[model samples]
Target: MFDESVSKKIHVPLVLSMFIGLLTILINFFYSVEDIRSEVYSSQSKELRAAYVNGLREKKVIALTNVINLSSNYSIIESLKSQDRNVAIAGLQTLSRKFKEQTIYKNIKVHLHDANLRSFLRTWDVEKYGEELAGFRKTLRDVKKNKKAIATIELGRAGLLVRGIAPIENDGVYLGSVEFMQGFNSIVKNLRKNREYETAFLMKEDYLSVATALSSSPKIKEFVLAVKEKNVDKDFLNSLKGVEIEDTKNFQISDEYFLVSEPIKDFSNVIVGYALIGEKTSMVETVIAKAKSSLLKQVYIIFFIDIIILIYLIIIVRKKIIRPIVDMEKMAQELSL
Candidate 1:
C-alpha cells in the first residue's frame, strides 16, 4: 500500500512536468517574435530619418540655385556694373523690395565689384541690421577662388544670417557678387513649425551655433563651443576637406542619439555647409515605452489562454492516465495483502 501511494505521487509530477515543458516552449517563441519586431522597427526608423534629412538638403539647394539665377539676370548685372552707385543701389533696392514681398526671404543686399574684384558699390540696410560688408567681402573671395556658388551660416553684428554668394558677370567680365540673406531664425522656426523633429544648420568649421530648434540646454551650448573649437583643429578639418557627406552615425551629445548629417552643396556641387538631424534619446524612450505596453498586453492575453489550456489538459491527464495507474496499483496492493 505504501509503495502504491509513492508511485501515484511520482506519476502526478510526470504529468505536471509535461505541461511545464510546453509553457517553456511558448515563452521562448514569444521572446523570439519580440526580438525580431524590435529589429525591424529600429531599421525602419533609421531609414525614415535619413530620407527626411536628404530631402531637406535637396530643397535648400534648389531654393539657393533659384535665388542665384534670379540675381544673375542680365539687367541686374548691367545695373550694378554702371558707374553711378545711386543707380545700382536704387535698382537693387527695387528688386529686393519685390523679392521680400513675393518670396519668403526678408532681405537681399547687392555688392558690386570692379573689374579687379574689389568692392566698390554696396547697398544694405545697416540700420535695422548692422553692416556685414567685411564678411561679405570674404565670401566674395571664396566664390572667386572656388568659381562656384558659396553658402554660409554666419553670425554677424546682425543677429544671424544664411548668406548665399553668387558671382555676377557682365559681358564675360566678372563684375561683383550678389549676397542674399534669409534670417536664420525664420528658417529654423519655419522648419520646426512644419515638422516634429529637431534640426540644426552648421557652417563649415564654425563652432558657433548657427540655428537650432532646441529651446535651451546647457549641454547644447557646450556642444556648440566644442564644435567651434574642433573646427579650428587643423587636423580634423583637413580630414573632412574632400569629403562631401558623412554617413549616418549614432552620436551621443549628452545621451545617445540617432544622427544623420549631409553636406549642403551649392549650384556647382561644392560642399559649402552641413545639415545635421538628430532624434533625441527621449524620442526612442517613448517608442520603447509604447512597444512595451503593446507587447505586455499581447503577452498577457497569450498567458491567459495558456493557463486555460493548461488547466484543461491537467484535468484530462489526471483522469485518463494518472487515475487508471492509481487504480491498478490499488488492485495489486489488495491482492498482495
Candidate 2:
C-alpha cells in the first residue's frame, strides 16, 4: 500500500509540473510576440512621419524662396510701375518665360497682383484672371499689411492650392504682391518622383475630402477621389483634428496598410489640412512572422529537452528508490519463510 501510494504521488506531481511549465512558457512567448509587434509598429510610424516632415520642409523652402526671388525681380517691379497695359503684359510674359527656362520652375504657376489686390497677370490666362483676387482677400491683406512673405494651403476656386505671396517693392513703396501657386497635382507628381510611396492630401470642409492622391497605378487617383466624395473612412475624418502620427490597425480600406498623418499649418500655425502617407504592411508582417517562427522553434526545442529530463528523473527514482524498497520487502518475506 505504501509503495502504491508513493508511486501515485510521484507520477501525479511530475505530470502536473511538466504541464505547468509548458503553460508558463506559452504565456511568456505570447507576451513577447505582442511586445515585438508593438515595437515594430511604433518604429515604422516614426520613420514615416519623419520622412513626411522632411519632405514638407523642403517644399516650403522651395515655394517661399521662389516667391521671394520673383517678388524682387526687376521685370516684375518695372511692369508694375509701367503706365501702358501692353508694356506690363509684355514684361510679365517675358518674366514668365524666363522662369520656364529653369527645369524646376517649368510647371509652376505665377500670378502678379496689383496694389489693390487685383490680379493683373497670370501664367495660365492673364485675360480671364485679370480681376480682383476674390477668394484670397484675407491672405492678400495679411501680406500687404505685414509686408512679409506668407505661405498657406487653401482650397481655391480651381482646386487645392499651396500659394506663397511676397510683397513687391521698388523704393520702399509696396507696389503689389507676387503670388506663386503650386497645385496639388504638381505637388503629388513631384512627391512621387522623390519617394515611391502612396500619398494623399486631405482638406476638411463640411467633410474631409481627398484633394489629391496617387497610388501604385495612375488610375488610383480616381479611386481616392471617389472615396473622398463618398466620405468612406469616418475614422480618418475624426483623426484629422490633431496631428496624429501612428500606424493604422486593420485599415477600413484594406489590411495591408500603415498610415501616417501630419498636419499642414498656415503662416499662423493653424491646421489647414493633412498629409497622409500609406505604406504596404507586407514589410512589417513578414518581419513579425519570421520572429514568431523562430521563437516557436526555440520553444519546441525546450519542450523536447524537458521531456528527456523528466524521463531521466523517473528512471533514477525507480532505480535508487522504488526498486530498493521492493527488494527489502522481498528479503524480509523470505527470512520469515
Candidate 3:
C-alpha cells in the first residue's frame, strides 16, 4: 500500500514537470523570435536613415555646383571688374536681385576684391565683426592662389558659406575677385521645404553649428547647444565612421533617435561638410507600439491554439494513460487490503 501511494505521488509530479518543461520550451522559442525581429527592424531603420542622409548631401552638392557655374559666367565677372564702383555695385545688386528671384538663394551678396585684387569688398557689417572676416579673407586668398572654381569656406560668425570665386581678367591684368555668398540658411530652408524629417544640421570639421532647422524655442536651442558641447565630434564621427553609410545605433537624444550622416563634397568631390538627419525617438516608439499591438493579436491567437492543443493533450493523457494507471493502482490497493 505504501509503495502504491508513493508511486501515485511521483506520477502527479512527473506529469506536472512535463507540462512545465513544455511551457518553458515554447516561451523560449517565442522570446528568441521576438529578439530577432527587433534586431532586423533596427538594422533596416539604420540603413534607410543612412541612405536618406547621403541623398540629401548629394543633392546639396549638385545644387551648389550649379550655382557656382552660373556665378562664374564671364559677363558677370566683367561687370564686376569695371573700374567704376557704382557700375560694379549696381551690376552686383542687379545680379544678386535677379539671382535671388530666379534661384532658391536667400540673402545673396557679391564681393569684389579691388582693382589691386588684394583687398576684398567690405560689407557694412564687416567693421562690427572684423575678427570673423579674417578666416574668410584667408579662404579668398587660397582660392585665388589655387584658382579653384568652387570651394567651401568658413566665415566665423557669418557661418560657413559656399563661395564661387571667378577671377576677372581685363586685357592681360587680373582685375578682381567676384565672390558669391550663399548663406547656410538657404540650404537649411531648402531641406526643410523638401524633406519630412526633423533635426537636420550641417556640421563642419570643427563641429560648428553652421545651420540648424531646430525650433526657435529656448528649450530646443538649449538642447541643441548641449548636444553641440557634449558630442559634436562624437556625433559627426559616428556618422562618417563607416565606409559609406554610417548609422548611429539607435541613440537617444532626449528620446529614442534614428540618425544617419554623410560627408558633404564640393564640385571636385572633396569632403567639406557633413549632412546629418535625425528622427525623433517618439516616432519610432509609435511604430513599436503599433507593432506590439499587432504582435499581441498574433500572440493571442497563437496562445489560444496552444491552449486548445494543451487541453486536447491533457484529455488524451487522462483517457489513455492516467485512467489506466489509476485502475492499476486501485487493483493493487484492493489486493493489498
Candidate 4:
C-alpha cells in the first residue's frame, strides 16, 4: 500500500509537467501554421501580378492590330485623299456598326488628324471636331512625324485609353494620322472572369478633370473607382476607402482576404492609377485547419503512449531496485541496535 501510494505521488508531478509541455507545443504549432499561410500567399501574389501584366500586354497588341487594319480600309483612304467630311463620316458610321457586330471591339472610336496634328474628325462625336490637338496629342504627332504607326496607353480628355495611331500616306505624301482608341473595361472584365481575381482600377484625383470616363463611377477617398474597376460586392468596394498603392506590395482587408495593388502608368512613365487585385483565403484556411487538426491528433496519441510507458518503467525500478535498497537499510538499523 505504501509503495503504491509513493508511485501515485510521483505520477502527479510528472503528469503536470507533461501537461505544461503539451501546452507549449500547441503554441509553437499554431505559430508555424501561420508562417506556412504567409509563405503560400506570398508565392501566389507573384503569379497574380504576372497574369495581370500579361493580360494588359495582350490587350495592347490586340488594340494596335485592329487600328492598323482599319487604317487600310479603301473608303477611309479615299475620304482622307479628297478631304471629304460627309463621305468620311458615312464610311466610319458603317465601319463602326460592322465593328460592333463582328468583333469584341464594340464602340471603337476612330479619330482623324490632319498633317499638322489638328483633330479633323471624331467618329464617336461628329459635332466635337476642329479642336487643335498639337499640345497633348503626342501619339498622333509621333505617327505623323515618323511616318509610321505607334500605339500606347495614353490619358486624354476622354480618359485613359489604349490608343493606336497609324500614318496615312498617299503616293509618298503623308496626309494625316488615324487614331483608334478603346477603354480598359473589357480587360478588367476578362481578368475577373478568367483568373477569379477581383480587380479595381483606382484613378488619381488629378486625372478626374481629364479622364471623363472615371468621373461618374464611384469615389473612394481621393481616387476614383474607374469604369474599368470590378468588385463582387459594394461593401467590399466601400472597404477600400484608404487603400494606398505606393510602397505597399500586398495588404489584408480581413482575416480571409488578401489584396495586392500595382501602379498603372501612362506612356510618359507617369503614375496614372493602380490596379488592385484581391482574392479570398478559403484554400489557405482549409490547409491550415487540416494541418492543425492532424498535429493535435498525433501529439495527443504519442504523449498518451509515452506517459503509459514512463509509468510502467518507474514501477519496475521500484520493484526491482528501490525496494531492495530500502529493505537493506532497515536491516542494518536493526543490526546496529
Candidate number of the best lDDT: 4
* lDDT by candidate, in order shown: 0.53, 0.66, 0.50, 0.74
Among the numbered candidates, top TM-score falls to: 4
TM agreement with the true structure for every prediction: 0.57, 0.64, 0.53, 0.73
**Candidate 4 lDDT, tens digit per residue, 222-316?**
77776544443454465566455553567555444556777888877788887776666675566567766877787778778767876786777
Off by over 4 Å in 4: 1-32, 228-232, 254-256, 283-337
Worst 10 residues of 1 by lDDT: 217-226
User: Considering lDDT, where higher is better, how would the candidates rank from best to worst?
Assistant: 4, 2, 1, 3
Using TM-score as the yardstick, the better of models 2 and 3 is 2
Query: Which residue pairs collide in model 4, if any?
Result: none
Instruction: Please provide, for model 3 over 73-168, each residue's C-alpha lDDT reduced to its tens digit, 9 standing for 90 to 100.
Output: 555555455544555455556666876799765456556564344444443232321122333366556555665454454433344455556555
Cα RMSD, model 2: 7.4
Candidate 2 lDDT? 0.66
**Residue range with the least summed lDDT across 10 consecutive positions in model 4:** 227-236
User: Which of the predicted structures, 1 or 2, would earn the higher lDDT when compared with the native?
Assistant: 2
TM-score of 3: 0.53
Model 2, residue 288: distance off in Å is: 2.8
